[model samples]
Target: MKNILYTVLLVIGFSAAGTAQEINWVSLEEAVKLQKKNPKKIMMDVYTNWCGPCKMLDRNTFQNKDVAEYVNKHYYAVKFNAEGNEKINFNGREFANKGYNPANANRRNSVHDLAHYFSVRSYPTIVFLGDDSSLLAPVVGYQTPQQLELYLKLFKNNGHTVFKTQQDFQVYAEAFKPEFTN
Candidate 1:
């Protein structure tokens, strides 16, 4: 009886401590396959190992329980290293970084061919893709969980399609109420 009480107490203590949850990130090819099976939007974190904002995005936003839980539930999360050497098969084509230097793997190596294919001009770009794997938008730079939730809910609900002009989006942004805790 004492052992059972102690075990229950331990479980309650751990639950109250609130262990961090992580977004289940899959490869680009895996994400594509998953999309065909389950049909969720893809949220690709286009990042480099040397990028500070990329690290901050991982720590500040991605690690947040609310953000991680919502993303894992609504999107097929992908971590794409902009300077990676891995060959990625996407949209019926293969992409690789031909000029990627092994010695500069941690530094600013050549950008992946897929990054150019997506027209990513900045680091830590959160590239959102449709269920059919078409590019929806590239949200560049670090974003707080609250800031990112606006994009998340908008894309998940296809709110971008209703926008006839940039002002429409601006109005939506102005009226947006973020539910995620920062």
Candidate 2:
């Protein structure tokens, strides 16, 4: 009886894990292209390889099934390495990495100009932008899967323009009830 119970639990766990959706990460250039076509908002995960919390965010928060589904549905998600050499053009300006330290022991890459443009002071900062590439607001520090979901829905549903304060958003969020079938 105990063996059977263990087997059932294992199967259930694996099944839940299998149902978790993968994040469709698009390139900065490709994201821009898609934006022109779809005109959806942008969610950029600004990260660095050497950052521990960034890895945790990718594995824990981003891997959540709801986070993946909601982001894929509502925003063009982009994973950007702050120290990468890739060139990006935004708002008639070209941005590139100017802070790379090739000789550093940890191989820390230099921060890109765009990171500075966004005023990113830490790793794993999630920046949400409007359809026209304007800053909507950035959620700094680490967030759990559930915490991240609230912000994802808030931006996706155009809640920022309506609610002005934390209390207002909390009231609005509490009122929201989504029904998902199948």
User: What is the per-residue lDDT of model 1 for residues 1-182, given as tens digits with 9 covering 90 to 100?
Assistant: 99999999999999965788889999989999999889999999999999999999999999999999999999999999999999999988999999999999999999999999999989999999999999999999999999999999999999999999999999999999999997
- C-alpha lDDT values of all predictions: 0.95, 0.83
Q: Which 10-residue span in candidate 2 carries the lowest summed lDDT?
A: 173-182
Report each candidate's C-alpha RMSD, comma-separated, in the order given: 3.8, 4.2
- Residues 1-182 of candidate 2: C-alpha lDDT, one tens digit per residue: 99999999999999988887988999767877888988988999998878899999998878877778878988999998887777898778899876666675255767889999999988889999988778998889787877777778788778899877889978976886643222
Candidate 2 lands at a TM-score of 0.80
Flag regions of model 1 displaced more than 4 Å. Answer: 1-18
